[model samples]
Target: MTEEKGSMLQSVIHPTAIIDPQAKIGPNVKIGPYAVIGPNVTIGEGTEIMSHVTIDGWTTIGEYCRFFPCASIGSEPQDLKFTGEKSFVIIGDRSIFREYVTVSRATGEGEETRIGNDCLFQASTHIAHNCIVGNNVIMSNCAGLAGHVIVEDRVVIGGIAGVHQFVKLGRNCMIGGLAKVVQDIPPFVIADGQPARCVGLNSVGLSRAGVSEEVRRELKKAFRLLYRSGLNLRQAIAEMEQELDSSEEVEHFLRFLRNADRGICRGTKE
Candidate 1:
């Protein structure tokens, strides 16, 4: 391999660690004791793999990422339909995987389990097969996303929360601890309780994200129409179009609602 596309020998690889010669290791990377890196893996520059971490499969980790002890990445999907197909796990830059975190590769050939940049995955978090996790997301300890789940940017999933397969957690939303999310969570809202109902807008999260108060007020109107009003989804959307003002946030909120094939989480349980 040429200098631009070659493995640079680590300055600090523990003797107990076993990394394949064919594996592509970037410059300044550190491998701790007992870590196992497979040949198919490509770790980017300056990444750190702690003790006992196992990285395998067709995985591409981004630059400056850190994997804590016992973190297992790029294992094949747990799906019953996976048949040894060639799939991939692509993680973006600056992500941190805490202890015992497991991120599985996709199930189908040529598919991918993709994670975006700057994400924080806490201990014991499980990202199932074919999941698409967007940037700046945070998954608390023990939170698990089932196969094919799509977590949009800046979402916060609380500890022990379990998201059902194929459910989409919209951008900037927050799922409460111990919540069971079975439906789609709309953007910029807080969802909680069993089966997960929309409690309110994630006002604090939006504020921290630097959302303007004017835009937030528009979102509050959208929330009221969607959750507080006695209207069905169609009615709520129609009301939103007629009464509420337009902004990027409001448009995104409307677009998420329009794609609620799995159905959005309700404000209350029947």
Candidate 2:
């Protein structure tokens, strides 16, 4: 197996493009027609800069990533109170930013906006400044994350979902399409609604990811205690502790629920 190499920078750059001589571009980095790479930009090896894309000040892009047409990265944050802060946008390796996606630079002085590796942002997705995204995450078309939101690893945010500011979505969680998530979503569950409610365990996702059946069984019981039973929040927690067998996954779920500052979603209505 030969090592996969990308298109060379000089060979791939279009003659009509404008790139700053001070920009740091690595080997096998492709810049498409009419693209713009600013002086403060540093593009890593094997990254492809597609047509009409603009990568501006203080942006660092890792290797082997692809940016689709018209993706505007490293633009100033949308915060009105911003006073030209010295901020940056950092994108990790192997991520894909689709057409028309917008990832803003960090909001405050000396801060940074971060995106993790191997994630996919579909067309028209917007990640606001100061947002933190984790690895292997998927943000569907038109999905948006407000400023300071935290999206954990392996999470799938459905199309057209609008996540409120300061919300934290836990690992392996799934948000249904068109949902408005204004609260913190716990790990390993499905959240869906106009205001987003916890429907149930993410069975399809968990099974596809090779989670054990025994673990799924325990999760089901925990869901029943927390959602189905008439017990209040504290009572539900107590019941889960006493009735279900303890496991790391279960404990993590409980801890997430307990720490929800914005509150958790409601379970499915019977």
Candidate 3:
């Protein structure tokens, strides 16, 4: 049910919810029992903030999103260098934050902790300061990402996985359960183990995403060249360029390799 409070048409807010008067709440939004919305927060239409969810700071949540019970968004950064600078947590549409998930705001002034559309952050997942999470990403239960981490589109982080600070997880990469990611992961790769070694191409994920078989074959060839061929990094890249026909997938892989400042994750053999 909805209510009209004076001139403003208020959305359905439970009686126990504490929403600051300065907060901008769109139509059809639902603030559940005991949920707290801070002054500078803006929740878009059709979003639901469940019981005991706390959304504070300068957070902006998009339409059709859901925050489960006890989820904490726009919380202060854990970094010691954060000195109350103005930062934001921006979430895109159709994302779901499961129970106890925590997303912290950025540390630097005017920076943002951004999450793209259609992402699912499972229970107890933690996204640290200044992280950029791309569309359709899934973080399983208890996954944790440190400050400045970048998770690209369609990536799946397994349960209890821990990604270190400043690491870049490339598109369609699958990180195994309990993996410790300390380096950059290139696109379409399956990484697992303690230090997260690249096992092989993410064939299942590619197939599920409707990637053409021809592209998969080329990626497999590139993977073999990079991991199995005993050649050095430069040699492998050169071989891939010379042997493989140019395609979007090949270009993306090469570009990721070229720009990886923290170094790419190596295979078990390497």
Which residue pairs of candidate 2 clash?
none
Worst 10 residues of 1 by lDDT: 1-10
lDDT of each: 0.93, 0.88, 0.94
Q: Which residues of candidate 1, in runs, are more than 4 Å off?
A: 1-6
The residue-by-residue lDDT of candidate 1 on 30-117, one tens digit each, is 8888999999999898898999999999999999999999999999899999999999999999999999999999999899999999
- Positional deviation of 110 in candidate 3, in angstroms? 0.4
- Which candidate model has the greater lDDT, 1 or 2? 1
How far residue 223's Cα lies from its native spot in candidate 3, in Å, is 0.8
- Report the C-alpha lDDT of model 3 over 1-270, residue by residue, as the tens digit: 346373225678888898899998888788889999999999988898999999999999999999999999999999999999999999999999999999999999999999999999999999999999999999999999999999999999999999999999999999999999999999999999999999999999999988899999999999999899998878889999999988898899988888888998999886
**Considering TM-score, where higher is better, how would the candidates rank from best to worst?**
3, 1, 2
Instruction: Write one digit per residue (lDDT tens) for candidate 2, span 229-266.
Output: 97777788888888888888788888887888887667
- lDDT score of residue 29 within candidate 3: 84
User: In model 3, which regions exceed 4 Å deviation?
Assistant: 1-10
> In angstroms, how far off is 68's CA in candidate 3?
0.3
TM-score to true structure, per model: 0.96, 0.91, 0.97
